[model samples]
Target: MFMCRGDVDSQLCHECIGNATQHLSSECSLSKQASIWYNECTVRYSNDSFFSVVDMMPGFYMCNTANFSNTKSFTPLLFSTMNLTADEAASDKKKFATNERVFEFQTLYCLAQCTSDLSSKVCGTCLRSAIKQLQIHCDGKLGGRFLYPSCNVRYELYPFYRSINVPSPNELAPQTKDSISKQDSRFLEDPFYLSYNCSSNHNTITSKNFNLLLSYLVSNATAGKLYHRVIMDEIVYGLFMCRGDLPSRLCVQCVTNAKDRIFSMCLSSSEGIIWYSHCLLRYSSQYFFPNIAETSPMYRDINITNHFISDQNLFTSTLSNQLSELANATGNSDERYMINSLKLNDIQTLYTLEQCTPYLSPQECISCLNDMISTQIPWSFLGSVGGRIIYPNCNMRFELFQFYIESDEARSSRNPSKEAGELFAQIGFILFL
Candidate 1:
């Protein structure tokens, strides 16, 4: 059996497999049974078939060669993480697992993997054997890996695994305790507003009234209504919605940026919508909250890199199937959002994302998505490689690459202030039209 380390990146896994095969053939040429382990992969060959069988012999243990001075706390946490990781790998469909645990001084990352051919019970037994071997041979080491013909486990202070490649709105800004506090304050104390019937009294509604309404809306967000509304002074109706995936900190920054930009740009319009990468801020004199229909304005952005080929029925059909499935899934979910994917070949894949404001019922969500698929989306877009269509209540998007990170994946920040400012400037210029 041959297996790659579960935590290794794809590129390294391939390279390590090649190296392991070549070395194992040369080093163990006389033996009837041979196995080799590399940093990223393992290879084994035997005269007899070893499928579905647990083998503990010919095991190897390698440690970091450096001893940890802080073994008292580190040993307990390391062993605990190893046991938990073993359980996770045994239960998961992949028979592989990675975990990170934080300590007072640093974080520990661990991975456990068994050959896919093993049964869950057999895999669990193999990992337990490997863990015991690791403890006996490398208990006080800074890092170590125990390798057997059927399973392997490793731990390190630094991250080693390649995480799923999904982009998220939270990437625009890092979450910090101070940033979370600042975001909460910004939403309550400052809000954008427009008066429809009272041009004369537009200036009459004091800043206090706007703050009070915005404070209510902000509170709604804390309660998990990312899309929420409030009425101010019995006149101004305001609504704000954060992207469902955005963290609280980025949500706040995005909304604050929208509010500041909209207020400065559209000073007295009776209706307006400010769109950001992670959120939307809108205010209107007319009631638009809980909009169940698909009549709200829509936004579209398309990728122009590739067009459909002449003989691409398989590709087109696969794309449509995935998108339709995502639409159905999103409509049926409590969050009203879902992601789906389809593989066209070894090299090409399509990913789709669809979402609706949670206020909409399942039927309303379905209707809203159907309207976009039929009317708003152009036929030519279906031939393109990627595109996004965003709406107030519902939005649908498809691309050739994965775009959304799962909720549990690790998150990192990318600065978005400059781009957001530029977008606000463009929207401001368009407001006059």
Candidate 2:
């Protein structure tokens, strides 16, 4: 059996299913019952009669361990959003619904689904069970996923899905940080795990030579010249929009600096990604955009202390408000913004950075930033001193301490100043965010 969200892109859907099938077939060949999950789809095979029946057996729940700032308000809001999305999904023919709702200033993204074969009631029950299970397993998590045999529920702070109803540029604006974070909760670390049809082109390599050439350039070029040269070579075409926000010289320098570190850390794999405090570099022959490929490698620092707060809800809620304000302010401006705030415990501070590709309209930039913020909040490592969201088109990050250098002149700040009005508009006609 296979299940997937209806809203996912066709190519991504197929790729996800294909991976699940191949993995399950090989990994569980002898077992009578087994299931495999990818970032985009899910596949299962069982000897017990489960084709039409809603089986909640073998359920799984995964959640971020971080606590929220305000438990009372956050829990109710979270439950309500999940319940609403699940109902919509159960009633819909495709068994999928992507929803964004507001709680205080925070916006939450949620996805709920069931196998197409199951009845609405069964799906609802399965989702409820999954939610209940998450309470025990995930508790005060920033994000969590509950998977059942017939149904599933995912809630997060970011937009994990590419909606079928793509918003027009005018309608796209930076949403509340809470909303973004909630949406991110639903995004699977691997989008291919959901249910969808697989195709022959699922994992086709699109540009092997180009990626190889870019890797070679990254390896040979000095840190200062590497970024511009890569862009000139068209290897970083997607990143071109960020040029206006970054100084031409500094942009090249940053890319070069990042390349040196990334090459040393990630090596020159044709299909790997290397992330730095300032930038991210991914060179994959496999096309990752539009189709929702989730194979990008992830790394988390384990050195940060994982101290749990006594009041999880308070921490999360407060953080959500702060993030929402930053997102809105940054989204409204042409330039990017960074803000750092101390938590209730003076020992720790929440750091945030928001940026849009120079090409994007303010609204588009906001929307993209909102999506990144939502997803990162959920998957962020517990007790993480730092976290980041690096999309092909846009990027954002936050850390406990200042990892980026800020120029004393203030005019040459690492992140563009919010006070700089319409910086992108003055640069070019094309919107890059």
Candidate 3:
């Protein structure tokens, strides 16, 4: 049987399931029994039936490297909260519970859940065991989680839960992934060919209004307003998005630099898009946020060292599929970004990334990614080892080697000067920010 983390939002649960199934099928191809955990979901299957059985073997635990400010008081409170949540979860038919405790400086959140198949007695036992494991393995940490096959427990000082603000569109109106897919043709127009008839109504704005707009870009965009709109005779719609994986400080700096550069480059034009090393900024006199996924007012950049490959078709096909999967995952993920690695052959690996501005709806993100895949990227970058395609709403890239920063070391390696140099180098070439 397959069971994912049941405490997450239902859509995230399904997305995690998809990731686990795909990964397990690929990574554990020959195994008769396998279990895996993604950040938001878990999946396990075995040849023999194990329903309602408490399987604790092969469990794992992780803790935040950072410790709380006041552990003497915090430790007791954390355990008390955990025990309360665990007992409630064990008794509940759904086998899940959440609790929060207000501390002097911050609030602590805890969650506990057991597989629905487990009986109340067995669930209680499993949760108690998980609590012990957490104590032994992650004591004194600010955040941590322990996972067993039957139950899982987690606590954190941060709001790790999904925000109620982004209400599930399904709750508002019945919509399934299939229904979203069915609307593809309507949103994902042809990539190779597109037609646009622009109006000549370029309503000129005063210098004062333009300066105000630029101020808004620097203030709001640098402060993390990924989407903003200002309307006059001609509406000024703006979007600035940093790479989803970047640290907050770097994201702020990247957007700030781009805002300054865009004023110099595109101040005269009412519609313009600019790309930086860590961010992308675009503004227009036209409103184009929620529906810009289908359009292709975009660009691309390929690595100069495009090594030749013997099997171009295989490479292209593999890359396309990977990018598509990443697109789907990113749209569904809370962060609107995903990283995946694919083995092109014995010697080479393809690292791929897909990201969308968090402001876009999940469906729009999917459409934007599909539109990129349908573009001439496959043909244009067929033999190239690495390349990126960028649009305003979303972007994707692939390389034979890992080019993205996935760790603290990678993020810290770049100083502000290096960031500026990289951005300048790509100004006329491909902007990969």
Highest lDDT scorer? 3
lDDT of the structure predicted as candidate 1: 0.61
Candidate 1, residues 342-397, lDDT tens digits: the string is: 54445655556677877788768766775565345433223344656667778776
Report the CA-based lDDT of candidate 3 relative to the real structure: 0.61
TM-score, each model?
Answer: 0.44, 0.44, 0.45
lDDT of 2 by residue, 409-430 (tens): 5335444433311111110111
User: Per-model C-alpha lDDT, please?
Assistant: 0.61, 0.51, 0.61
In candidate 1, stretches whose alpha carbon ends up further than 4 angstroms from where it belongs are 1-225, 303-313, 381-383, 409-433
Candidate 2: Cα lDDT at 12: 52
| TM-score, structure 1 vs. true | 0.44
Clashes of each: 0, 62, 1
Structure candidate 1, residue pairs in collision: none
> Which runs in model 3 stand beyond 4 Å of their true positions?
1-203, 224-235, 303-312, 343-347, 408-433
